[model samples]
Target chain A: MVCELCAVAKKEVESELLYEDNEIMAVVHLKPAIPGQIIVFPKHHYPIFEQVPDKIIAKMFKIANKLGIALFESLNCHGTNLLINNGVAAGQTMAHFSLNLIPRKEKDGLKLQWEPKKASEEELQTAFLMINEKSKELHPDLFGREEKNEELVEERGRPKEIKLDKKKENYLLKSLKRLP
Target chain B: MPEEEYSEEERKAFEEKIKRMSPEELKEFQKRNCVFCQIIIGQIPAKKVYEDDHCLAVLEINPAAPGHILLLPKEHHAIMPQIPEEEIGHLFMAAKHLSHALLRGLKCGGINLFVANGAVAGQKFQHFVIHLIPRKESDGIKLELPQREIPEDILSKINEVVQNRFNELMGIKKELVKVETKEHAEKKKEAADEEESEKKKEETEKTDPQEEENEDEKSEESEEEKDGSISLDDIASVLNGGR
Candidate 1:
């Protein structure tokens, strides 16, 4: 169940270790588009960008913002690209959620190379809506079981078998029991 | 401050009002200020699929991918910091089921969960909600990481601490979502009924004579303008010629 991204995520932390919190992590990009092209990610390993919880996602963005400020002041190019590629067709090469904060300059040329197409107004509207409606369906809970081998192949890669804490589990169980 | 006192009649009136409220009113009251809450309440409409007592899952108006759904707490708080423990469980549980529905129902290629806790964190919704974004390999979403090795101890520690917190949070969310969703499908149906009102409103407006008159006038005005109708350009030409 070795996803390339997860293998890399699990392999080891490298030079991009700008910041690391329990819930969040930041690193410099491997193939940076701009000079200080840093990308920040949540350690939780949410498979897609949208499915990450609001709280965790917020924290990740806060870290991203801090990095954005850093890149703006220290690196001093022009602006930064806080890019996130959601799916394969959208240009996603990795499985984990990340915000690519690539520093930008006016002339340095990094274009998305977008070619907008017409979808036959009505059909285009339907397609426009289809993206949101369908994505709404595929939630991070897609791989629900605490651990699944296939999910490991699919999502954040099998969460490494870090030791479980009884106290935490108990706390979760008790809280969940009171859900109603 | 002491609880505001209500006389018997007042209390009775309040009960009556509650009864009269129509789920729309309750939902308005339920959400303090979240636009997403407004979307759920039919003040605005969203493409919704999965719903339960505790929460509703809807497609994001602005989507990052093909299957991006916004998971909202039916009852609104500004953010997770404001949500009660019971609510936390309720939300995630609904999210879990909705996610499954997405995978099997929609046949999504993959799924992701997202949430924003605060303003600095890109939380566009004032009312707390999580986003469930579906994925395709071509979407180009990945976590940028260091190319070199991170110490095992550091990684282990990060995993240990985060998992404990995540399990706690996720566990609570699962419970709440499961418990509340099952209990309130009937209430949710009542809410759905309000959308019928929205559709009826649309139908009436579509058929309304005044609306038709306005459309006719607008069309006539545009046609005349297109057909060399009076305009500043004509006046400017007239002025130039006179000069």
Candidate 2:
């Protein structure tokens, strides 16, 4: 089955397209959670947030921020919510990753808030150590080593397109097909 | 004057003072009042999970889940609109990593990255923050965003208004110009990066005076104690049924 958001990105389906550029698209949500809610997604088919490249994620968020400000101005709402449900358990209905910019007002009766749960001191400490170590391990590239290399490569010539290996590509396609 | 009348007069004078202040002064005043800024500057102790130059991630004292984290930018931005695009990008990138860490650390099923831009959106604090809530099956957190069928005409009207406003904010002509070759896009991105770095330098310089002001306020006000302290009983109850 064709991804619904892919259709939206390609403009195959009728959508209230708000903004479009080379890499991203923003359109007004049809069945909105709130009035003036907009959905922003990348042109490429990334089934999950982790699959999307860092640069595209950044670009999507920056665009979402702009659209968020637009919602505030146009709808005259009190605020906006930038929400991303990354997996099935997190209430991600669609396989295609998208960001929701929900316009909100005072006492709008949106039930997004949760009662804060308390974790034990040991649990909190373990979490802190585990996350700190994992973050340090995963975020070295973001701290400017590989990013500089990519920039240098781009400066030298045309930016290199990242090609996934055949196995990884197959895995991604399989996962996409597996998801509803 | 009566005591109530005297206090009301004082409150009015304070509001007038705030209104008369410059933008920089207003920012400093807000910074002095923000609790998160105090947490960032080491005035208030927090259980920090991650910290970089651009942002800090701390475990929520009252977490929605076991490892829920609140990622905050070091600078004072009251809302999403006030933040620069580059800073927004950086913050989200950091958030992505933090979410990943939450998943791996807590062994949760998923993650929800949530940001409330203003008071009506359930933003209790004045500081801009991104909430990374770790999700497990039957976690009992209901962040259900139920869809409503809006009228077609209303959607169209909203579309036009928001699209026009967005284009205006983004500079429509500049966006049109940006539709060009890959080389041109790369060049433009590099130029934007340089400009962002320059802006960061200017912001750091601007924050120095605010830091001094914060120090003065710190001396004047004894840190007011805040509740919501974690306890083992609360955690035991959460572990038993909440999650």
Candidate 3:
């Protein structure tokens, strides 16, 4: 519900529509956490950042980098935050996906409020171990990516069946609540 | 009119197409029209390029190369990011086969398989299509990737950033599979679908940050050669012309 940005056209008023193209739109965030806050948004309204295709995501950054540099030069800012909130639980107030460019200056008095929760040596090791095992358990089918085109041609001959596993489904739901 | 204005007509036409779908409808667009979906349903028609129980591939009508095809799941979903570890392996295995087949089918050169997710990345259709842009040296296929040397430290940071994103996608995949709500599943998938592109961006950034900068600078002078952009011949011409 939050990706109202895509449907919006800046009509040379209200907020500045910095850039526009077939794949994404770069617009000035009306409520700038910093004076030059901009959001590089994909034209399509995908709910989470990952669900959108990879190519578009790549291009968005390519443009964003350009804009980031422009924001750096034009605004003469110190640092920048290239951020996207993934899900509702992850402080994602809006369902629509986009990246935020928060330009930082010396004394604007804005901070991310990130307090480090460092783990002890053993705890950190165990955490790393568990995550490593999870990494090894990777399934190629996990992302539904196809590597080549001939297979797509060959696929022309097969029947489509979308599969969803119940156990992992539950595990995933439980996991989202504690997203790191 | 603003000084650097884009076309309003194109944007409006584009908007009309985008608005027709509810998110639920958008998710189903692929399942309903996807060749794999059709193959599963025994609808439409296709010449199978490759197949396994979990995934498959088919020919693209409008091919970027001679053996252009699409590799996808037998079960339809848009560009999803995180998948089960096993499923990720299988998908890669499917890709391996397609790469070989592509070698067989095209007979000439390299593979440039990529997916364009959102409209901003030029995903002309809503079906989460991956463009398996096959490249042949003779065929003049070249990707317009900028080449530059990134600082090793910066590259390391980028690697860490991508790795984190990759994990985030994995988590997202779990979330999608769990919810059973089409919206939830689709939403999570959007984030994962983008990983390939982002990783590639990092790759490009690593290889040549200057390429994009060069392309942008040269756009005005070489508008004629731009359509024929990303060709080895074009690169050679530019390289030779530079000297």
The model with the greatest lDDT is 2
Recovered native contacts in candidate 3, as a fraction?
Answer: 0.00
The recovered share of true contacts, given per candidate in order, is 0.03, 0.71, 0.00
Candidate 3 C-alpha error for residue A89, in Å: 3.4
How are the candidates ranked when ordered by TM-score, highest leading? 2, 1, 3
lDDT of each: 0.50, 0.74, 0.46
lDDT of 1 by residue, A58-152 (tens): 45655555555555444344554455554443345565656676544545544432222333445335543554354343443432333343442
Better of 1 and 2 by lDDT: 2
TM-score of chain B of each: 0.47, 0.65, 0.48
Clashing pairs in 2: none
- Estimate, for each residue in B1-243, the C-alpha lDDT of model 3 and write its tens digit: 125655999888867876898878765765775645766556866545545566655555445544455666665554333223344334544443354334333332344444433333234443333444445544443332212332332222222222233334324332112122345445544654465357577785563565455446444434533332233343223222321
Overall local distance difference test of candidate 3: 0.46
Top candidate on TM-score is 2
lDDT of 2 by residue, B1-243 (tens): 123444888899998999999999998888887889989999889998866666878998888876889999999988888888877877777677677667655656678999998877888778899999988668887765687776665666577667878999888843322122345445655665665567668796776666566456543432211111233233223212311
Error (Å) of candidate 1 at residue A74 is: 1.6
Q: DockQ scores for all the models shown?
A: 0.04, 0.29, 0.02
